[model samples]
Target: METGVHPARQPGCHPAHNPRGKPKRPTGRTDGPSRKIEVRALAEELGATLIRAVRRDADDELASVGTGHGPVTISWYAFALEYLDMRWPQIAAKTRNETNAALCAITQVMLRDVRGRPNDELLRRALRDWAFVLPRPEPHAAPPDVRLALRWVARTSRPLTDLMDPAVMRAVMQALRLKQDGTVAAPETQRHKRMTFVNAVRYAIEQGMLDSDPIANINWRIAKTAKRVDPRVVANPAQVRSLLCAVSYVGSYRRARGRRLVGLFAGMYYAGLRPEEAVAVTLPDCVLPAEGWGRVILHVTRTQAGKKWTDTGQLHDERGLKGRPPGETRPVPLPPGLVAIWRESIQTFGTASDGRLFFNERGGILAFSTYDTVWHEARQLGLPSDLVNTPLAARPYDLRHSALSTWLNAGVDPAEVAERAGNSVEVLMTKYAKCLYGRAAIANHRIQALLDEYD
Candidate 1:
């Protein structure tokens, strides 16, 4: 009789089948060939049915899910893209970039652990440089390898439902706390990432993807961070004057490049203006009297956050003074020394095309790199070797700290100092508390006077 097994299923297909003869059965089996064939077909049919049922169930689960704003059937990658689209237009460029970074960090752990994984470094680059910057026009096409890696990630990323798991949330927090080298991130960086994650989770809740923020349920401890200014970095009055004099000597061949910044640096030392605010100061903003104290009305500040993080694609972003609302101005009184310095600078160098008191040779806004280089050289020239290695006025920003500390130590009211420095009184007292030298001595003197009366 002819067998039901096809000729294609002969000896070569299985060791049990003989090419020259009928197929052989196991020695212990008594079942007939037809019965075995029926059983095999039935098993195959059941497997197919089971697979189809599983796929159907998955589809149903996805369909039933909804984010408060819309459906939650999308993968994490898709959801992140949608979130960026909604937020891109409403936030500042720096904020957008920071959010992108945080999301990229979160995405690192929001993937399924699948086979054929890409190199970690390549995958990280793809997420940070391409996937996260969703709204920005890509400057160049990704390489073939990067494209392939990103495609793999997109395909294997977990769905939004997976984020509800406490384990997944833990993974995200852990990822944010680590650097690329697997070391702990800096405290400030960790804090920023945590804030970003918290905001994103809150957005998820709003959309109805999550019922609540998982971060709130977890107890996470960040490394201790120092918020106070170090007194060691503060420069004394004599040292500041010496540094200013040295600034005029830097790049002496470049038509007094250093000299142009002397007044700018002096403004930071005298008026407690941030470097950005001082750079944004204009002729109209200043009311420099002939001999007495003058005033500077600071309504705006120009901060450099790089072209990529600025909407105008310029190096600096002009915004309202830090922590202040637009159109609000802070009037900082300039000491007589700064008034003289400002008047002399205007008389000698005139103003930029826009009336900015400070500018480069082309009458453009001063480049941060140029001023930083000038400061480095001046520090070397002005500070003695021992002090040079120390933290005394180590950075341009230190000048502002030094100025604020000087004001506090001079017994200036905390509220008045806060107004001049564009900071809250609490911040002034907390951050500069350590920098207020001689306060302990004064307190001790008062205590001694009380003791003498008792004696």
Candidate 2:
């Protein structure tokens, strides 16, 4: 007559075979002491229990799998575990042991019961947050932040269930929703976050834990507030000349470094090479005649990190290139003087052990800090302090801008200029349109002369 005592607890009922709507176990009679399976082995044999739609334990039904480390049910939304079960070998083979370990750790964190309901909404959110902030996998594979986050959860949360509270989710959302310290996050960052969360939410829905994806509802337009950068900081011919003269007259203490700096600046300013591309230049990249001018070809670029993200945005090592595909090559041409400079670097830096033309004292790519410091010192000695601070001729990259503007001003065809500098004619004309005055005057004068002849 509808007794409240759990049927399994009724007298004379076999705990293993209780039939009053209790969870079904594997169909086997209990063997004697030596025949009972170990807990872990039973779990393996009972993996089919995962497909059950009803609560198998009271703790789960009551949401009592709290922070004290009691056994908890596995979550339905454990994408990391499912992903690992299916893709562990693939992930391991593609990256390193540390990465594989991180994946495993995260899987454990996500798969642990939350809400005692065998759901992994929180884990999905964590994965989404991580994938959002990480840089695109280039120069190297993904950093260890996912692994770090998993470890953080393990250490910080009491039982994994504690992490599943609605309040916890609210806190997480609040922390992540922060704007970039008054400045907007870069568009790339914003886009990545949205995509990461979107994918994670999609995974959750696919795993049957969610009816729909929450990430799908959030507006992503807030990221658009970040300003677009103008790429036309290149110098004019007069400014280039002044910059060159400034670079040429380094103090005796900095003479050797200055020469190297001049070569780099000239390569970028005169040849329109990105700073990294300039460092990758080699003797073979340069083509010079005994009597006349020739071209320089830039095959690669070297990148550095750390110092660059500092408030100063300076750098200190050679990490990788931009534009070029991994192991595939890209090239740019140079004028006679730049050709000569590459030749001199070849004789001096002696090429990387790998035949790279520029390197640190240890034969690595030159440090951005070393070059930046040298550039500042060069400025102090060569240009007025007022000029040094002004953007008119500040920063190494401005040389590339100057180079492009000079080409536009010197009557070079827009198509030719764009092709040489790896830009579209439309883009060049739009951003640097105001900086093309000198070349426009030349074109105007030549056109006037032609008109005079017609008259």
Candidate 3:
């Protein structure tokens, strides 16, 4: 039924005129699809006065029922039912009154049938059974219907209304985990679903329905080591050098699969650039000098979130680096060799239509197929079997870890290294501390030299 305020009495009735009165109990029993009683009876039962509905704003057909708690009006409900009767394809205007009467049955449900069920369980059931599923058949979706279902479910879910509480939010969050199809099956998957569930719970609490927010208590702790796979396994320095030396800047061999792949990994390793960030580099972004090292300034990168699924193989939107508050840039210095590779790459494969450093033959964003194909060729040619089997050097970014660690082991100061690599000292130390094992004896010898001075 159409639901909205009635014209004659949009503000409802005043409590002073109604006073408190006990409702009249139903004396008769009728079966088969419960029907609404006369407005007088309902008004009396609800301790309200029946206001009649009228054709215009001041008309008389509209009715208002009064009560000590608030005014309970029936005119709008009757009008709404009439409106629904007309709108239904199968119902005739002659049946409008009856349909209106039936629509009013909802009052009984509101006042009696569902008054005390646990809100959370009800919301969970609604989400599981209907919410997204039921709306797919419709042309457009009504978020409110879904929200109301969720709200009602929350109201009925029991003593669990607060969102800030860790346990409560954890439970709610657990409900939104992404299923295999990429929609919210539970609370984790993509960031949006997690945030949505958290916000919904927070909304319930803010509305004064719950006492606390359960999510506030969650501890966002890191439970695993952050090291990239070792690059030595993928390609050692000597192997990398050999791979780069084999490619030329011209002809079919220049366009041969491994040239770009070699340049890609070498750039990632020596420049310490993330794949998305590295892919955004253009001919203009590369600054090379004739005799020494140069720099590659990464002005854009692609990151995905609610707008795109990670499994879709979509490109990250062009944007500044992660954690760089908008407007800032991340610049990585290029070793002389990598600069040489990029110069050759540009001469071989012309810049993408948009001046991007990399693209497919059609000038579209480079696809994973191209990347993987190039990588496989470079892998077989540039890496040994034992190192290839190990995890440390399994992927492109691992080369970055290798480069960063190599610099650190060469005795680069942590602060200088971190700044050059677009990382903080804390991250630098955490990720490559183990790589420093090879330099431990050298450090120990220095410590001994200091001790000798004391002696």
- Model 1, residue 5: distance off in Å is 36
- Per-residue lDDT over 266-384 for candidate 2, one digit per residue giving the tens place of the 0 to 100 score: 77887887776777666665565654466755545555544312223345333234443445444455676666766666666466776666665666667767767766776666666
lDDT tens digits, residues 125-144, model 1? 88777766644444247787
- Two-way lDDT contest, 2 vs 3, winner: 2
Segments in model 2 whose C-alpha atoms lie over 4 Å from true places = 1-152, 155-213, 223-232, 248-255, 305-329, 347-350, 438-455
- RMSD, one per candidate, in order: 9.2, 14.2, 17.8
The better-scoring model by TM-score among 1 and 3 is 1
Q: Please report, as a residue range, the 10-residue window in candidate 2 with the lowest summed lDDT.
A: 131-140
Off by over 4 Å in 3: 1-209, 215-235, 242-255, 304-314, 448-455
Q: Which 10-residue window of candidate 1 scores lowest in summed lDDT? A: 58-67
Better of 1 and 3 by lDDT: 1
In model 1, pairs of residues that clash are 68-207, 68-208
How many residue pairs clash (N, CA or C atoms closer than 3 angstroms) in each of the candidate models, in the order given?
2, 13, 47
Error of 3 at 130 (Å): 13
Which parts of model 1 have CA positions greater than 4 angstroms off? 1-72, 138-143
Q: What tens digits encode model 3's per-residue C-alpha lDDT throughout 239-322? A: 656544432222266356555555666677788777767677777777877658988777677532211212233443445666
Give the TM-score of each candidate.
Answer: 0.81, 0.55, 0.56
